[model samples]
Target: MAGFFDRFRKPEPEPVRAELDQAGYEEVLDLIRADHKVPAVKRIRELTGLGLVQAKDLADAIEEGRWAPFPAPGQSLADRVRALLSQDRATDAVRMVAQETGMTEDEASRFIDGLDQP
Candidate 1:
């Protein structure tokens, strides 16, 4: 009799946590860098099936460096910094230079600042 009663109970929906593959992650990063965060969050929700709040949190995490994009193979650090600078991500460019080349933050800032000088 108890077994029969159990059949009427609805199963609870499980929360899904999805991890983005390289391509998806890269796309999200590009969207975020382009200042299209709404689209980025929408993409995240599509890819991960997360709710709006969760998707927004994920996008924020990516922006805050809780996640990192894969580096392009064979790309030099200088080239990468220039690319970031071109995207108006100067702070991120400076951090990348400092991290990869063991330069002080001040040195990295100066290096990035000098990249466009004649």
Candidate 2:
């Protein structure tokens, strides 16, 4: 009579650490903002002049903020996006805010979309 307890138990896998250079990280961010259509990996290559694999590694590090930005003042998205695309992802930005603030994605998207409207 075997009980509900299972015989197999495994430990959780460790997180993988990426070896990233600080200068490369900052350059990737700049490229992403500059060329809106470029995917994360390509932006990394163009900016750092690194090969594909190295570029991707750098981009991943930046997204996780392994090398995050220092607090600073700069241009607004409205201006930046206007230069890039006619319509920007206001909803996506709102969702990101919601995720940080512990609000539901739907609620955050609604809130931001409303703000954008007249």
Candidate 3:
């Protein structure tokens, strides 16, 4: 009976391809050196064609001196929440988000709800 229900669970999202090209490497590094995270993310997205989350991850990695493009999948908080939700652990997911982000319970609930959409 449990096996029957397992077939209907949502699959985890595919990991983002966040490889940075050499063309804009210097410019992106300069932005990071200047402590301009948002602009660095935008520039990374432009160069690598990654999504906002992926670009941000790449930028963070670069800043940390760990610029390897590939890492464990679903490394972001949103991805962790999504993983928990997929496993039918909504309460745990909400609690984890609230604790990690210092969000109120209501805000955390809304944040989890927002993740339900595409």
**In terms of TM-score, which candidate is strongest?**
1
Q: Score candidate 2 by lDDT.
A: 0.51
| Residue-by-residue lDDT tens digits, candidate 2, 70-102 | 222584533432322334545435534454556
Report the C-alpha lDDT of model 1 over 1-118, residue by residue, as the tens digit: 9999898999765576666766888799889989999999999988888889988998998876556555779987778788777777788787777776788889989888787532
Against the true structure, candidate 1 reaches a TM-score of: 0.50
TM-score of each: 0.50, 0.33, 0.41
Worst 10 residues of 2 by lDDT: 77-86
Q: How accurate is candidate 1 locally (lDDT)?
A: 0.81
Candidate 1: residue 116 lDDT (0-100): 59
Candidates' C-alpha lDDT: 0.81, 0.51, 0.73
Q: Relative to the unseen true structure, what is the C-alpha lDDT of residue 97 in candidate 1, on a scale of 0 to 100?
A: 77
**Candidate 2 Cα RMSD (Å):** 11.9
Q: Which ten residues in a row have the lowest lDDT in candidate 1?
A: 63-72
Task: State the RMSD for candidate 3.
Answer: 18.0
Best by lDDT: 1
